[model samples]
Target: MAKFRKKPVVIEAVQYEFGMEDGFVVDGRYYDKSGPVPRAMNRIPAIKTLEGRHEISKGDWIITGIQGERYPCKPDIFAATYEAVE
Candidate 1:
C-alpha cells in the first residue's frame, strides 16, 4: 500500500496598480527620504483577519510553518514559496 501526506499552503504579496513592472516606479520628482526605502510592490499582500480561523491567500503575507517567519510577497512568490511543501 502507498502512503500519502497532506500539503501545506503558502502565501505571498502582490501589487495592484495600473501599468508598472512590479507595481513600483522610481521618479526623482517624487519626495526623497533620508535613507533608501525598501521598495514594496503595491499589490503585495500583507496580512488579513477573518472569522476565527487563520488562513493564507495568494498575494497575502504569511509566516511559514517550517521556519515560523513572515514576509510580504506576490501570489507567484507564494506559489513558489509553498511549492516544496506541496
Candidate 2:
C-alpha cells in the first residue's frame, strides 16, 4: 500500500455583482457572476459541516476561513468589499 497526500492550489476572485439582471444574491448581496465581467460568479458557494460551519461563495477572497471556507467578496470590488477573518 502507498500513502498519498493532497496538494493545495490557490485561486483569486471578486465579490461585486455583474448587475441586477445578471446573477443571484444572498442576504441582499450579489454572490453570482454575470454581465460583462471577465469572469462571472459561475461557481456556487460550497458549504460543509465537518469540524464546523464552512462556506465559500463564488466571488470570495483567495484566502480560506477558519472552517476552510472563503469569505464572500467580489474581486472587482477591490479590497474595500470584504476582509478575510483570522
Candidate 3:
C-alpha cells in the first residue's frame, strides 16, 4: 500500500453557536438556521448538504468545499484538519 497526502485547499467556513437567529445568512454566503422544530424544544440546528440534512452542534464548523458543497465538521476534527489561510 502506498501513502497519500491531501492537497492543500482553502475553504470558507463559519462557526455556529447557540442563539444564532433563524434564517441567519452571513456574508451572503452561509445560510444557517434552526430546524423546522421549535427552538423552545431545543432542537439542533440543521442544514441541507450534498449528502443529506446534518445536525450542527454548537462550535461546529460549516465548511464550503471547493466544489461549492457544504458539510459539518466537529470542532476538534476541524481544528486538526484546517488552519487560517491568511
Candidate 4:
C-alpha cells in the first residue's frame, strides 16, 4: 500500500444563492441558474461538470477546479475541506 497526500491548491468558488439571474457568471463562465419553484420558478441550480449536470442547492459552493471545471460542493463538506485563502 502507498500513501499520498493531496497537494494544496487554491481554487475559485462562489456560493449559490437565491435571486441570481439565469445567465450569472462565475470564474469567467456563464451558468444557467435554477432551482425550486418557490424561488420564482428558477430551475434547480446546477453546473455542467465532466460527469454531467450537478444540482446546486442553496448555500452550496460552486468550485472551479485546477483545470477550470466547475461543480457543486455541499457547504459542510466544503467547510471541512477548504478554507479562505485570505
Leading candidate by TM-score: 3
lDDT of each residue in 1-86, candidate 1, tens digit only: 99998675553323333321222223322212333434744323223223222323343434434444443445666566555423
Where model 3 places Cα greater than 4 Å from the true spot, the runs are 18-42
RMSD of each: 12.1, 12.5, 7.1, 7.2
Q: Write the per-residue lDDT of candidate 2 for residues 54-80, one digit (tens) a residue.
A: 344445444344456544434556466
Worst 10 residues of 1 by lDDT: 20-29
Q: Residue 80 in candidate 1 has what lDDT?
A: 64
lDDT of 4 by residue, 1-86 (tens): 99999999999998987653243344434456453233234445556779876666788888889999888889999999999998
Clash list (residue pairs), candidate 3: none
lDDT of 3 by residue, 1-85 (tens): 9999999999999998766424433333334454333334434566678886676778888888999998889999999999898
Give each model's whole-structure lDDT: 0.37, 0.41, 0.71, 0.71
Model 2 lDDT, residue 38, Cα: 32
- Please list the residue runs of candidate 4 whose C-alpha ends up more than 4 Å from where it truly belongs after superposition: 19-43
Give the TM-scores of the predictions, in the order they appear. 0.24, 0.21, 0.71, 0.68
lDDT of 3: 0.71
State candidate 2's TM-score: 0.21
- Colliding pairs, model 4: 34-43, 34-44, 34-45, 35-42, 35-43, 35-44
